[model samples]
Target: TTLLRQIAGFDFPDSGRITIGGESVERVPVEKRRIGMVFQNYALFPNMSVADNVAFGLSVRGEAKAVIATEVQRALDLVQLGKLGGRRPHQLSGGQRQRVALARAIVTKPRVLLLDEPLGALDKALRVDMQIELKRIQREIGITTIFVTHDQEEALTMSDRIGILRDGRLVQEGPPEEIYNRPKSEFAATFLGDANIFRGDSTGDGIRLADGTAIAAGVGAKLAAGAKASCAVRPERIRIARDAGTPDGNANMLKGQVSKRIFAGSNSTYFVERAGQTLKVIVQNTGMERLAEGQDVVLRWSPESTVLIAAN
Candidate 1:
């Protein structure tokens, strides 16, 4: 109820401002806003065949029969579901039904499109297909879209820019590359992907862990020295080298005993334990060079790959 009232152009001081196409939407009507929405659960009428469903929106608009048919066909063609128009929702696959719902929302050529969990109901393969299809549709239509989903992967894969929300407040918003590579906060870093948060305790140029193992974290040791600061690095960036000799530099090397290793076909994960903390490293599948299950390996990372996360 509150959302509808707000989207209908009311403003709440605490919630901040909302805008569309350079204009403030505080006084715009739903019809004038030109926004389209597609929900989860394939919210199509079960009894309505695919063609009727596509034409439903045009019919409600009092468009001519000839125009409705043309628009319906165009919409179906847009989603690549034209051939299945004669079939009902029950007759179509989960992916196909979602396409019908998408066609209905997009046929009007609205200025903005909003999708709420559009591919949640589909299986993995179907979900991947729909992800590409949705990206293509948004690009071709050139509509400013705001997609809402709890899945970070979906948001990262789809949006032109991601708006990360938490606890009813927007915490971060940025391009996918920035969000993935250089998260502004520690929470955003851990929430979006796998991050190993470690504390750096150092006096000068030397950084030591809890167990007195000194290493280089690629940081200058000026900011994190004396004061406790956090370090964050991606799993894939942690390289496993089997050399017995110690690393030349002290900035980004750590000695860890391989505690657990799991092979998942295309990729593998290693859990290394040192100083009572488990660090993770992701290895790729190069059939020729599979890492062993148990090896006291040196976890190495480059200065560029290590992200010095600030203490919260």
Candidate 2:
């Protein structure tokens, strides 16, 4: 209900201001906001041609026929579908239909555009291509867009700033790298990607693992000694097989037995077991002897790379 209901007055503590061209729009009308929205589906009329659908928004606004034709042609050309103006939604492929829908939304010349899972309907390859297309179009138009997507890659690739919403609350919001590399909470770390979270024990001066392994991380020193802590390291940063010893600056190294291995395209993921729990590590087809299951391996990560977080 919280997500469905649009309250009359609700302002988040910190989502930046809702402004358009330097003007505060706290009480602006929804339609007058000049904000265009593109939904998951193409939302094109089956009976209408590409030109008619692209011109729908302006026609609804009671614009002149000449203006509508001009805007429609320009919008169609923007999507590279000018030659398909006579084709209806039924005649167009999924990707082509989406392009038409996008052209329609932007034809109104909105200051801000909102995209709700815009590429969700396309297949994997088409989705990736559309993701690039969407970003390219956004850059070309230069509109401040707020995109909603469940795909992490899409959000990180397209959005200038991503607002992660969970359970009706905005959990985390930041640029792609900041949100992915420096998560403020454990939830953020795990949700954004796979993480190797280990229980940390605070030493008198620094933080260490529960197994008496000390990390070179000084940020966790803010916590009192003997305090419980939580630390995380990304799978990609952990080296699977490195001659069974320390490599360099990665002070946090743990020896674990490979319990399971799963191949995923170019990268193969391994589940390692240590200290009665499982940890994950990903290795991109490095010519190292294909790590076999049940083989002992050392998980290595840089001291600075391991995110030292407080126990939540």
**lDDT leader:** 2
- State the local distance difference test value for candidate 2: 0.77
Off by over 4 Å in 1: 1-15, 201-227, 244-246, 287-294
**Candidate 2 deviant stretches above 4 angstroms:** 1-27, 203-206, 218-222, 246-250
Worst 10 contiguous positions by lDDT, candidate 2: 1-10
**Cα RMSD to native, each candidate?**
3.4, 3.5
Candidate 2 to truth, TM? 0.88
Cα error, residue 218 of model 1, in Å, equals 5.8
Error of 1 at 24 (Å): 2.6
Residue 257 lDDT in model 1? Answer: 84
